[model samples]
Target chain A: MGLTRTSLTAEIGRGANYTDKHDCVVALAGNPNVGKSTVFNALTGMHQHTGNWSGKTVGTAFGRYTYDERTYSVVDLPGTYSLLTHSKEEDAAKDFLVNETPHLTVVVSDAACLERNLNLVLQILEVTPKVLLCVNLIDEAKKRHIKIDIGKLKKHLGIPVIAITARSKKDIERLKEEITRATDNPSESAYTVQYDDEIEKAITTLREGGVGTRFEALRLLDGTPEAGGDSVPSGAADAVAALQIARTAAELSDEIAKALVKTAEFIAKEVVFVEKATDMRREKIDRVLTGRIFAYPVMLLLLLLIFWITIVGANYPSSFLSNLFSSFEMPICRFLQRLGVPQFFTEMLVFGMYRVLYWVVSVMLPPMAIFFPLFTLLEDVGYLPRIAYNLDRCFHKCSTCGKQALTMCMGFGCNAAGVVGCRIIDSPRERLIAILTNNFVPCNGRFPLLIAMTSMFFISADTAASSFWGAAFLAAIIIFSVMITLFVSSLLSKTLLRGVPSSFTLELPPYRRPQILSVLVRSLLDRTIFVLGRAVAVAAPAGIVIWLLANINVGDASLFAHLTDLLNPLGKIMGMDGVILLAFILGFPANETVIPIMMMGYMAEGTIKGYESLSALKTLLEANGWTWVTALTVVLFSLMHWPCSTTLWTIKKESGSLKWTAVAFLLPTVIGAITCILVNFVFGFTL
Target chain B: MISLSYTPMCALSPGECGTVSDITLGGAMRRRLQDIGLIPGTSVRCVGVSPLGDPRAYEIRGAVIALRNDDAEAVHITR
Candidate 1:
C-alpha cells in the first residue's frame, strides 16, 4: 500500500492533513493511568477520536500527526502491561501490533521503574523490529531520583530511544522527529534467550509451517492465543495434535518452562541495572506495608483514617456552603412572598428542587474534594503498588493476579472505571472475575447513602460527639463493604473462574514525599468536576421528577407517598419504610441525593432545618421511627444494592454484553435483598 | 525433595518446558510474556485451568503466570 495522498486532511478534517508516502504506522502503548491520555492529547492535538476494534468493547484511539507535509496515523492502543491476551487491553494491543503491523511501534514506559517497563518493550522487540522505545515520564522518574541512560539503552537494544515527558510538547516533538527518521520495516533482530531442548524441539516443530520460531516459542511461554494473530487457529487442534505426533504433549510443555526461566535471567542481566545498592529505607517501609501480619491491619487503618478525614473535614465546609445557599433561598423566598407568589409553587421550586440540589453539592462536594486528593496523594506517593503487593495473596486465592486489587480499589471511586481498570488482569477469566465482583465494593455515590442512613437511624447529629461517633460508625459500614467483596470474590473464584491464581512479579514502587500541591489541584479539578458533571447531568431531571412526585396528589396522597405506601410491606420486611425504598428507587440516578429527597418528603408542609450534626439528624429520624437495626439494614442495603443507572450503562459499555450488564444489575440486587432479609430476621428490629 | 522455594518445579505443559531450547519471538507476543518473568528456564508449572478452558495459570518460582491454553499448546516442555 503505497502512501497515496488521499487528501485525508479533508477526510480527517481541519485538524490534520495527509501528504504522500507517509509510510509509517506508530502504535502508542503504555500502562493505565500513566498520563497516556495526556501524551495522546499533546501528540495529536484535536485530531484524535476513539473507535472499537471490530468487536471488542475495548476502545482504540487513533490520531493523525502532520510534520513537514507528511501525515502519520498514530494508533493509541489501549494501555497494557504485556501483550498477553488475558485482558481486553492486552488482546487489543497484541492484535494491533501482530495483524496491523504498525510500521513504527512506540512503546511508552514509565521512567520511574525502568526494569518493569522493559518487560513490555522486550515483548514488542520480540515481535517486530521497527520499534522506537519512548521512555516517557522523565519528570516523574527524576522526582524519584531515577536517572536513565537513554543512549546506553538505545545502544543495548539497537533501536532509537526517546526520553520524553509525555505531557510536554517539546519532548513529544523530539519523539516525532525520531519517529520520522525510523525505518518502517527494519531488519528483524532476535532478542530471545535460550530455552531448554524439549521446549525448543516443540517450538521448532510448531514453526514447521514456516511461521517464525520466536513467535511459537513466546506464545508457548506466555500462553496467550492472539499473540501471533491467526498464526494458529483453535479449530486446527487436530492439525496441532498431528504435528505433535512425534512428541508427547507433556514433553512439549516442560521444554517451554525451561525457556521461560533462562530467558528471564538473560534479560535481567542485560537490561536491568540498579544505580544504587539496596537500602533500608524502602525495605523498612515494605515490611510494615507488605508484612503478613501488619499489612491487612495497616490497610484498614489507612482506610479508616481516610474516611475519618473525609467525614470530619467535609462537615464544616458542607454546613458553611449549605448555610450560604440556604441564606440566599430565604431572601429569594421573601421576594417571592412580596410579589404575591403562591406558597406551594414557591416551596416546590425553591425548597423542593433547590434544597435537594444544594444538599447534593454541599454534602457530597466536600468529601469528594477532601477524599480524592488524599487518595491521589497515596497514588502519587506510589503506595498503590505496595497495596497490590500486600493484597496479592488474597487475589491469588480468587484465581486472579494481585494487580486486580488496584482495579477493585478503583471500583470504590467508580465501578465503570474499575471495570475498565481490569485491563491490569492479564487473564481473561481473572479479569472477568474482577469485573463481576467489582460492584460489590461501594463507590463514592453510595457513601452518602450509607452516611445519611447512619446519621438518621443509628447516631444522632444533634451533638458534636454524636456526629463524630456517627461518622466512625459509618466508616465501619464502608469496611463491611470490603469484607463482603472479599467473601464474594472467593465464592466466584472457586465456583465459576476456578483456577490457581496467575503469578505476577509485583514491583513495590518506592514511596516518595507526595506532590501534595500538584496532586490536590489536578485531582480536585479532574476527578471532582468529572464526577459532579455526571451527577448534575443525571440528577437535574431526577430532581424535577422528585418535585413532581411530591406535588401532584391523587385524591388524599401524592405520587411519591402513594408509591412509598405501595412499597411499604416489602420495605418493612427489611427494616425500612416505603419512603426509604422509593427514595432508593428514584435515587438510582445519583445515590448521594437520596437522603435530601427523603427529607423533602418527610417535611412536606413545614420548613425543615437540614440537620447540622449527626445527633440532630438521629433525633429527626427517631421522631419518624428508627432503630439501630434499621440503620444497619440501610447501610448493608446501600453497600450491596444495585448500582446507579450510570454505572449500569458503563457496565453495558465495558462488558459489551447486554447479558453481562443484566447480570451485573440483577446479581447485586438479589444478594443485597437476601442479605438484608437474613439480617433483619436474625436481629429482629424493635420499633 | 529439598524443595528450594526459589527454584520452582519444572511442571509446565509439555511444549513450554525445553532443555535449553532455541526460540525467537518477535513483536508484541515476546514482550508480553517476558514482562511477567516468563523468560527461558523459568521452571513454569501449569497448575490450574481457567473456567473458559483456554488460558491456563502457571506457577513460576513464587509467582503465578496465566496464559491461554492455545498459548500453552505452543510451549514445548521437556521432562
Candidate 2:
C-alpha cells in the first residue's frame, strides 16, 4: 500500500489500464439528507436506498467502485449531525473512523447548508486527519443562489476540498479519481479546530503524557466514549495508542463543543455566499404542509389518496394473479401424478404449500407493490420529518421522542423495518417505547385484510358511496391504531421505561425531487419483493404445518377442529369464534397466512383456496356467523395483536433482550385481548 | 442569571429573528444544542411552528431545526 501516483486521466479512463487491485476502502460520512447516499450510489453504482430525511441510512451500506484499475470499496456510514454526542448510530460513525481507519474518509456535506454541515465535518477531522471534503449537492446550492468558494474552503479547512453535484457522471468520475489521488498521498491538515484555552491546556497535558493525539484526549474527556474494545483489526498505531489514553483529561465541557460550533460557523460564513430566498420559498410550502389549519387534513388526505390508489389499482392485478395461479392447479397436480407422485404428497405440495404461496402472493403482493413505492416517494421527498414535526406534541405527551412518528410510518410498511428504524431515536428508553408500540400500527401484510373487512362490514350497501367511505373508514382504523400506539407508549413510559423525553434536533430538510423511476424499481425490489420473499418462505412451511393441523384427525374430529374447540370459549368472550382465534394463533409465523388459515377452517375439506370477490368472502364470513360486531372485533384484534415472527426477531435483535422481546410480544397481545374481550363483553350485553 | 432584555425562545413568533443571548439547558442536550451552532451570538429565526404548534422550526446556522416547546424555551434570545 505504498504511495504510487495514479494519474487522474488514467483513473477516469474505463478499462484503460490493467494492474493489481488495490481494494482501497473509502467511507462516506455526512449530515443527514446531504445527498451522501447519492454520492455512494454514483460512486459504486448501487442504489443504496437514498431518501431525503434525517437518519435515512440507519446502518452502514457497503459498495465497490473501480478506479485506476483498482476497486475502491465504499462504506456509507449513517448520517449524523455531529459525532460529539453519544448516540448509538453516531458512535458507529465515529467508531468506524477511529477504529477501522478507512484508507480515505470522504466527509460529504450539503453545499447549501454548509454552515451546519461543517459541524460534523470538523468533528470527523478531530478523529482522524485522513479526510477528503466532498461538498455535494452543488447544483441545488447553485439553483438556490448559494455559492461556495471551494478553494477558499479548502484553504480554511486545510483539507483537500472538491465541490460536485451528484447528478453529473463527469463529477462522479472526478470523485473517483480524487479518491485515488487522496489515498495515494495523504496530507495532514494544517488547520485544527482550536478549542478554548482551558481545553487546549488539558489536551496539552494529556499530549505530553503520551496520550497519543489531541483527538484521543478529547475523546477520553467525552462523557461516554465507546473505546478500546476491538482495535486490533485495523492495527493502526493511533487506535492502539488511543486505547492507552487516560480517562482523566477533563470533564465533558461546554468549551470544547462551543469551540467546534464556533469554528464551523466561522468557516461557513467565510466561504459561502447566499441570496437567502430559498428558505422563504420552502417555508411557504412547509407552512401549508405543517400549518395549523391544513396539516392534519393534508396528512389524512394523503393517506386516503394512497389507500384509494392502492385499492383501485390492485383490484385487477390481484384477480388476474389469482386466476392465473388457480388455473394452474389441475395441470400441476396432473403433472405431479404422471411423475408417479403419491396422493398425500400431491395433496400437500399442490393443494397445501402451492395453494398457500399463491394465495399470499396474489392477495399480499399487489397492494404492497403499489403502496410501498408510493410510501417511498413520500420518504424521498422529505415529508417524513415534517410529519414528525407535526406529531411531536402527541409523542411528547406520551414521553417519547417525536421521531417515533417516522418509525411508525415505517411500521406502516413493515414492523421489522420500523423496529430497525428505531435506531434513529437517541434515547434507549424512547427507542424501546417506539419498538414496543410499533406493532400497534398494522403493517402492509395486515392492511389488505383490514381494508377488506372495513369495506365488507362497516360501510353502507351503496356501491357509489362505499368507496369514499371505505377509504375514510380505513383511515379511521389506522388512526385508532396510532392512538393505541400513543396510549401504550405513554403507559409503558410511565410504568416500565419511565423517563423525561430526550431532546432531538429534527431537521426539516429541503425537499428533493423524488427519483420516481428508481423509487418504483427500488421499492418493488427492496421492500415489496424482500417482504414478499419472507412471506413466501414462511407461508410454505406454515402451509404444511397448518395442513397437518387441519387434516390429521384427533378423536372423532380433526386436530384443527379439536384445537379450535379448545379455544372456542375464549374466542366467544373475544367476539370472534374459535376458528378465527386459531387462525390468528397459527398465523404467528406470517400475518399473510392468517386469511388462508381462516379460509381453510371455514370451508370444509381443508383444501386451500382464494375467493374471487370481496362479496364472496363477506358471504363466507357471514355464513360462519360473522356479524358487523364480529367484523369490528376482528379488525381491532388484527390492529392490536402480537407482532409476527420476523418483527419479533427484529425486536429481539434490536433490543438485545429476551425480556423486552417478550414484553413487545405480550404488550400488544394483552391489549388486543383486553380490547376484544371488552368489546365482546359490552356488545354481549347491548347488541 | 436571567437577563432583562432576553425573551424566551418559545415566545418568538414566525418571521421574528433573534440572536441567542443564553442557553439555560443542562447536561448532554445543552452540549448537543451548542454542537449544532446554537451558542451565544448565533442568529436564530423562528421560521414557523408545526400545526400543533409545540415544536417550532428555527433557522440556525443556515438550517431549519425544530425544537419542542420545552427545549425551545430554554434558549434566551433578544431581537
Candidate 3:
C-alpha cells in the first residue's frame, strides 16, 4: 500500500525526464541476444537477469549507476530487431526513444554479427541523435577472428563507437566516460540513410529536422497503420496530401527497408573484415541435434534425464526442510503464549499460516531450485530454439505458431510465466490458444505432488529401481498432458480462436558455452524465489482459511465436513471423494498447498502438511478409498484443472478480456472432469 | 554456359547455397526479411533441416534463421 522500492524505481523508469534532478536517464537499446543485458547487468551491479537466447528481457528493467559523481538511472529496453517493426519489444523500444528522449541512449551491438546488429543502430540514430554505439561481445568476435575497424566505423556512423567486451571492468569504465561525453554533447548529425531519388525528393517536400525529421516523412509514406500493421499513427492523410506521392505505402516501406539493408551492408563491407566465421562448430552440434535419427531421441532423453535428476535430488532437501520447519513450531507457539498473546491467535498463526507456508516452500523450493537451473542451462546452450524448430511442425498442425513450443517450455517452470511468454507469439489467436492450453503442462508446483502420488501408488517400494520407475511415470504423465495440450490447442484453433498458423522468423542463434555461474544465480532468483514468493503469498491466507474452515462448527460437524459432504456426489462421479475435490478448489490459491490441504481434510489436523512417511500417507488415502483408479484420476485432474489464482490473474491482464480468462479457466476444468469420469468408467468395467 | 536455375528457398536441401532472386511474401514478414539483409543479391545457405523437413535453417549475413515452409516457399533463389 505504501511506496515500495520497486514501485519507486518503476516511476523513474516510466519515461520520466530527470534533467532537473541529479539523475540522468541512460537507456540501453539493442537487438535480441546481443549482450545488451550483459552490459546492463555489469553497469548496474550483478543481480539483474541475463540469458543466452532472445526475448529474455521482456520488460524494461530499471537500475541505477553513477559515474563522475553523477547518478544515472539505467533503463534496459526490450531487445528488438528494429524500431520500425510492430513487435511488442520493438514498439517499446521505439516508444521509449521517441517519447522519452532520454539524456543519453546507448546502442549495444554484437561484434560478431555486426551487420545484422547495425540494422538496429541506424534505426535508433534516426529516432534520437544522442546515441552512443557500444559494440559489445568483442571476446566472441575475437574467437571467430572477425575484425572491425573502429575508426572507419566511427567515420561511417558519425557517432562515438566503442568496441569492448561487456565483462571487462576497464571497458565499463571507458563506457562510463563516454556516457559523460555523449550526454553533454548530442553532437554531429548521424549518418542519414539515402533512399531512392523519388523518396528523398518526397522527404524534401515534407518538413525536415526538429519535430518533423526525414525519418518522420519516410514513416508517413511507409508506416501507415493499415500497411503490415506498422505504426506511423493514423494521421498520415494530411502528410499524404502534402507529398502527392503516387506509390503505395507498402512499396515506399519496402524501398526504405531495402535502402536500410543496403546501407548496413555497404558500411559492413567497408569496415568489417572476416577471415571466415567458423560457425562450423555450431553446425556440427546441430547435425546431431537436428539429425533425423537422433533428434527426437535426444529431446526425450534430456527430458527424462532432467526429471530423474529432479525427482532423486529434491527428495532429501524437501524432507529436511519439512522436518526443520516442524521442529521450530512448538517453540514458536510457546514463545507466543509466554508473551501473553491470545491462545486462539497463537494457535492459528503457528498451526494455520506457518504450516501452509512451510509446506509450499519446502515442497516447491527444492524441485524448482534444481529444475529451473537445468532448464535455463538448456536455454543458455541455445537449445530452446531448436526445440521450437523440431516441434514447429506439430504445433503448425494444430494451427498455431511454432513459438508456442517455447511458451510450453516456460510452462514447465511456471504457467504464469508461460502465459506471459506467449507475448512472443505474434498472432493474437495463436497467443490466446497458447495461454489457454498452457495449464495442461504441469508446472513445478504440481511436480512435487505428481512425484509424491507416483511414489505412493505407482511405485511398489522405495528403492533405486522404484524411483527410476517413478521418474519414468512422472515423465509419462507430462507426455500425456502435452498431448492433451496439443489436442485442446487444435480444438480451440478450429472453433473459438480460429485462424491459420502464423509465420514467424525464428533465429537459431549460435550455441555459446553456458555461463554456469550466471545461469544458476539467475534461475535461482528469477524462477525459484519468484515462484516461491507467490506460493507463500497465497499459502499464508490459504492456511488461515483452511484452519478456520476446519475449526468453525456448523451444527454437529465442522464447516469443512459439511462442505465436503455437500460436494461428495459431484466428486464421486469423478472417482474422487468430496475432500479431494475440495482440496483442488482450496488449492486455487497455490498448487503447492493442495496436498497439504487434502491431508488436513482427511486426518482433520493430525500429521498434516508434514507427513511422517509414505506409508502414513498411503493409509490416510486408502482409508479414503484410494485405489489405482483414484490415484490416476487425481493425477489427471491435477494435470488438467483450472490454473492457480496467479496464472488466472496473469491471463486476465495479458488477454485484457474477462471472457478469455474464464475460457482459460473452464476449458481445462471441463476436460479434467470428463477425463476423470472416463477413467473411473473404464475401471468400473474392468475391476 | 549453365543457365541460372531458380527454386523456392524451401527446395534447397541441407548444405545447398543460393542467392535470393525474389521475395513474394506479403505484409510484415516481407519487410522483416528485407530488413534483415535478405535482399535480391544476398547469399544464403541451407545449413540444417529440422527432423520433419518442414522448417529449414538458413544462414544469412552471418546469422542463422529458421523459416517454416510457408514463409520460405515465398522466396525464390538461384544457386
Candidate 4:
C-alpha cells in the first residue's frame, strides 16, 4: 500500500507543528530500550513526553530545543529494530524518514549491544545521508566492559558519531554541538550496503529508469514499498515491474536482506571491542525468572507482591487524603454558608461536585501513586517482557497477540490507558480483540468498590483476616476477569475478528538498574497525574448531573428515584437493586464515584454528601437492603461492565471509528449482564 | 565438515545451538525475523521456554528474542 501525498503532508504537520519556527527538524530513532527517549527528554527538557515501553510512542512526539542560540524542533520516532520490517512502528519511522525528510536524523544505539542495533542504523543510513549516530548508554557499556570506537565507526559509516550517556547532561552539550555541526554541514552519507550482483543490477535499472533512489528501488524490490509518495514515474513503474519479475526469478529480496545483515555484522566487528566477556547476569536471572517451572509461580508472586504493596501502602495515604479533603470541605461549606449562597446551589457545588471530587481523588490517587511507580519500575528493570513471554502461549492459544497481556496489565491502572496501549499490537484484528475485551479487567477506579464490597460482605470481621481475605478475593476476581478476557478474545477472534494470531519478535531487553527518581517522576507525571486529571475533568460535570437528578422531583419521588424504579426489574434480574443500577448509569463518567453515587441514592439525598467511614457506609448499605448477593453481583458487574465515559471516548479516539467504539461499549455490557444474570439465577435457586 | 540435516528452530532443545539456514515464512513475518538478527548464517541458541511452553526464547546476536512455536517452526536451522 502507498501513502497519499495528503496523508504524508498531514503526518508531517502532525509530527512537527512548529516546523515554521524551528531552524531544523531532527528525528530521533533507535532500537527499543536504547534510551533514545532519554536523549529526547534531556535535549528537549520538559518539552517532550517519553513513552516507557516499546511501541508506546506510536506517534511522533515533537519538542523544541535551543542549541547554540538556534532553536530546533526534535521529533522522537517510535523505537524500531529495523526499518525493513512491516510492523506499525517500523512503518511510522520509515514513513517519517522517507516522506518528511527532516534536516537531521539521529540514530541512537545502545553502546553495550551495538551490533544488533547497527542493523537499523545501516537501514536508516540508506535513507538519509544527513544522519548523526548517537551511541548512548556508554556508562552501561563501561559497566559491561564493552567499548565502541566511535571515531572508527563514524569513519566506517561516513557519518558523524557521538558517544554519550543519555541520563546525564555531561555529554548532552557535546551532542547538541554535534547535532548543530551535522545539520550545518549536511553531508550525503557515503554509507551503502552492497547487495548481491543480481539485486545490484535490478536496483541500478530501477534507479536509472527514474525511480526516486536506490532505497526506494530496494524497497520496491522487497515487495513492500511504502505507500503514499509522489506517484512513481511511468518508466519507473515499468522498471519496477521488470525488476519484480527478475527478483522473483532470482529471489533477490532475501539476498538483499542477507547482504544488509552481513554488512552490519562486518561493520560491527571492525568497530566494537569486548575487553573481557563479563558474566551474563541477565541470562542467569532469566533462567530462573523465565524457567518453565518457576516462571508462572514467579509471575504470580510478583503480581501479588505489587498489589500487596499497593494495598497496604495506599491505605494510610488514602485515609489521610480523605481526612485532608473532608477537613477542607467543612471549611468550604462554612464559608459558603457565611457568603449567603443559595442552599441549593451551595449543596450542588460543595456536597455534590466537591464530595465526588474529594472521593475520587482520595480513592484513586494513593493506589495509583503506589501502583504506577512499581509498574514503571518493573518495566524499567525489563521484567514486563518476561511477563509477556510467560503469558505468550496463553494469549496465543486464545488466537490473539501476546502483547495483549501487556495491554491488560495497563488495564489494571486504567482501561482508557489500556485502550491506548493497544497501539502496540500491530494487527488491527487482534488489537480490536484486545481493546474490546480489556474492560474485563477491573481498573484502579473500580478497585475501591471491589475492595470495600469484598471486605464488607465476604471477609471476617477481624481486621487482619479481612485484609487478607480482601486481597485474596480481589486476586480471584482479577484472575476471573483475565480468564473471561481470554475466552472473549478467543470468541471474537474465531467469529467477528477471524484471524490467526500473528507472530511478533518480543525483544528481551537487557535488564538495567532502574533509576528510582526517574521511575517515580515518570509514573507520577505521565500516568498517575494524567489519568487523575482526565477522571477529575469528567467527574465534576457528572456530579452536577447526579445532583440535578436527585433534587428534581418527578411527581411523588425524585427523578433519580423514578429512573431507579424504571431500572428495578433489570437490576433485580442481575441481583442488584434499582439504586445500585442507577448509580452505575450515573457513574459512567468515572467508576470511582459509583459507590458514592449509590450511597447518595440510598440516603435519599439530593447530592453525594459524605460517608464518615466504611462501617457507617456499610450500615447505610444494609439499611437500604444490600445483601451478600448484592455485593457479589456488584463486584462481578464492576469487573465486566461497559467502560467509563473517558474510556469510551478513548476507544473512539484510538479506534477512530464509531462502529468499533460501539462494539467495545456493547460487548462488555452484554457479557456483564449475562454473567450477572447467571450468578443471580444460580444463587436464587441455592439460597 | 558440515551436517546438511536441518530442523525447525522450535524442535531444538533448550541450550541447543544452531545456525539459521533458511526462513520458510514469507512477507512481513520473514522480514521481521530477519530484522531481529535471525538472518541466514547467524548463530542462535535456544535459551529457555516460557511457563506454558509454546513461546521459547533464543539468544541471537547477543540479544534474547521470544518466538512462539508456530513462528519458530518457520525458521530452519542447522546444528
Go through the candidates in order and give each one's DockQ: 0.10, 0.76, 0.76, 0.70
In angstroms, the error of model 3 at A160 is 1.1
Better of 1 and 3 by lDDT: 3
Per-residue lDDT of model 2, residues A110-208, tens digit only: 888898888888888877778899999898888889999999998998778889988789999888888888888886754688876656766666666
lDDT of 4 by residue, A1-687 (tens): 001121223356573554764468999999887888789878887523343356656666666788788888888888898886667788889888998899999999888778888888888877888889999989988888988888899889998999998887879989999999999998665598888776788778877878766777777777665577436767677766776775572266677778888888999899889886533787789889988678877877787788778878988998899889878877887899899998888888887788778778888899989988888788888888888888988899889988899889888878887887787788898898988998989888888788889888898786776777777887788889889999999999898899888877787877888879877877787777777888899888887788889888879999998999899999999999898998888999988888878987888877675467889988988998878888899999998888999889888877889999899889989988998899999896765
Q: Write the candidate numbers in order of decreasing lDDT.
A: 3, 4, 2, 1
Q: What is the interface RMSD of each candidate, in Å?
A: 10.1, 1.4, 1.0, 1.5
Q: What value does the lDDT take at residue A595 in candidate 2?
A: 70
Error of 3 at A20 (Å): 6.7
Estimate, for each residue in A1-687, the C-alpha lDDT of model 3 and write its tens digit. Answer: 001122234456566653346689899998888888879878988466666666656557778877888888888888888777777777777777777778888999988889988888887777677889999988888888899999999889988889999878899999999989988987586787888988787666554322255656666667454355334333544555555457777777888888888889999999888998658888999999988999988988898788778767998999999999989999999999999999888888888889877877888888888988998899888898899999998998999888888889889878987887786676888989999999899988888778788988899967889867876787688788879989999999999988888777888888888889888887787667776776688888988888888888889898888899999999989988999999999889888777877888888762246667879989989998888888889899999899999889778977899999999999999999999999898895665
Clashing residue pairs in all predictions, respectively, total: 93, 0, 0, 6
Ranking by DockQ: 3, 2, 4, 1
Per-candidate Cα RMSD to the true structure, in Å, reads: 8.7, 6.2, 3.5, 3.8
Runs in model 2 lying further than 4 Å from the true structure: A1-22, A196-198, A221-252, B1-5
| Per-model TM-score (chain A alone) | 0.75, 0.91, 0.93, 0.93
Q: Which ten residues in a row have the lowest lDDT in candidate 4 chain A?
A: A1-10
DockQ, model 2, C-alpha based: 0.76
Docking class of 4: medium
Question: TM-score of chain B, per candidate?
Answer: 0.58, 0.91, 0.89, 0.89
